[model samples]
Target: MGQQEWMTKDFYAILGVDKSADAQAIKKAYRKLARTYHPDHNAQNPQAEERFKEIGEAYAVLSDAEKRRQYDAIRAMAGGGARFSAGPGGPGGSGSFDDVFASMFGGATGRGGAGFGNGSFRFTSPGGSGGFEDVMSGLFGAGSRGGFGGFGQQPQRGGDLTSSTRLSFRQAIEGATLKLRVEGREMTVRVPAGVRDGQQLRLRGKGRQVPGGQPGDLLLTVEVAPHPVYSRSGEADLIADIPISIGEAVAGGSVEVPLLDGSSARIKIPAGTSSGMKLRLKGKGVRSSGKRRAGDLYARVRIVVPRKPSRDVTDAARRIDEAADFDPREGLTTQAGW
Candidate 1:
């Protein structure tokens, strides 16, 4: 952006935030406004599209600490409403604003260089060594080279875009490629394996395009649907709750557990296995893209007991309980004491 344009535009006002607003507050305001004015949400509305662009520009400047500071200084120095005239000293011409910068930097007041027409004037140093961008580079850091038409104006990068896609749990774990339409263009996106729900993927140079600057990126958020029998845990682990009878928990045996790929695995339950115990199956979880090993599967035990028992069954249970003589909650009082 040009210094002159920056002086005229109220970035804070555009974002509906105070000049003293913190970085988070500024970001919050920008997101809200961007969503409201986004082109996808406001088809055929030129005003909204323009507003969205303005909001993006404001955010791009305000989000960076150094850029915000420099912008504030410039606005304050130029009184927030200064305009650059098209010519040398005269009424409605290059005045105090131009003269102050020129005298301070020893820059000559002229026009037509840096591709600016006779109708527009620029504050440039002698022999085109420095212009507004050059001066800014000297003061802060280096600015955009050339000019607006000829390296005087900074290249305004296109705004980043956000979109989302839905995936089944299987697809999320195994990976899939799907097509998504963004900004009226259909793009094929690769949903990486082991991607968690609500994970965001950034696609560079896949956003709105501007004439003379770098294109923005696309922020794609993935939403994975829930599975009926399976769930996930840390990194790439898979979890499944397996139900076993009281006899199985006490004696223990092999049980058939369902796998994600329409198969089953025989898991051996150790003798006297208790409820809530987990069995780990190596190399049975979600697979990563390449080289990295797949994760493991955890089967949690849930012991089920009969709700209603016949007289004979109750008698047998009483005889077994007497023979075992085990107190399951023996240390409950002391262990749970505060």
Candidate 2:
């Protein structure tokens, strides 16, 4: 931002903080304003967007010890005893830091050169190298990028910030509003439904803000916790292992399976169904979240045998097995060309 801007804009007032506010106080104030004016939270208010930007800019400058020092120094140098102005002369223009710097370096050396004289600020380039703005950029961190590089534009957009969160498997599939701590401050972020684990959610205008540029985004990484009874498959299907009694598997029957949505779905087990057989319930897995389509639920059947059999039951089982003459794996080797 221009010196005029830093000189005029009351950053402390904008942030509703005292000039002597401590680092913690400044941070607390900024976070409160950031949450209040966050674009997503106040989308309907154009003024809030602008206010949010202002709050960020103030925070960015004040939060950094070095930048804060420079800012205070600049303002101090511009106050009483001396006045700042363009086109040298006196009070209104001369006798200021600019005039002192010019005098220090014999005559107005034009832009683009190397270090000059004894130990007087070891800069790579002899700074008087460009427009007046370039000179300003060198003294104060503004107008140019890479700071002392050269004078051209205002500060670039604020840097992007990163944060992470843990979500329940169900929460990952269903949209949720999350409160997260970012850069040691608390802010609210939205997690869209159907968000896969390891995916990132970008919260716009929710990052650091440059003095005179666009605010950056907050990149949120999501992690879904594992579920004991259910798991997510590559096809977005929800899976579960269902154990059924031998009788239920041998004769077609209905089995109630748990769903990710905390509900139960009844699936039919075909007659003579074997262990490891899979049953599917279309559109019964994870419900649609955002643009994701509904997913299916797959249940793998596991047949449980009776731990102990009565003499009569054992005899009846042997008779039934003898009558059925079926061996599911009998032709496995022949099919493999054994």
Give the top-scoring candidate (TM-score). Answer: 1
Q: Which residue pairs in candidate 1 collide? A: 146-150, 146-151, 146-152, 147-150, 147-151, 147-152, 147-153, 148-152, 148-153
Prediction 2 global C-alpha lDDT: 0.66
Q: Could you give candidate 2's per-residue lDDT for residues 1-338 as a string of tens digits?
A: 45446666778898898999998898777766766776668768989867766776677677767767766755665563443333312222444554445543555422223233321221222443244344455555333443232333445556556555678988887778988766566888778777776555668888867776877777665667787767788646777889998678777799899776668888888999988898988887766555356788889888887789889878877886788888768989999999
Residue 308 of model 2, lDDT score: 93
Index of the highest-lDDT prediction: 1
The deviation in Å at residue 200 for candidate 1 is 1.2
Residue by residue across 1-338, what tens digits does model 1's lDDT show?
34446667999999999999998798778767766887768998989877876776687677768768767867776774544443443433344345444544466443333333543344454354444555454344333443433444555556566665668999999999998887578878787798887566767887767777777777666668899778998887899899998678878899999998899998999989988899999999988777378999999988987889889878877887898899988999899994
Alpha-carbon runs more than 4 Å astray in model 2: 1-155, 306-317, 335-337
How does each model score on TM-score?
Answer: 0.58, 0.52
Query: What lDDT does each candidate get?
Result: 0.72, 0.66
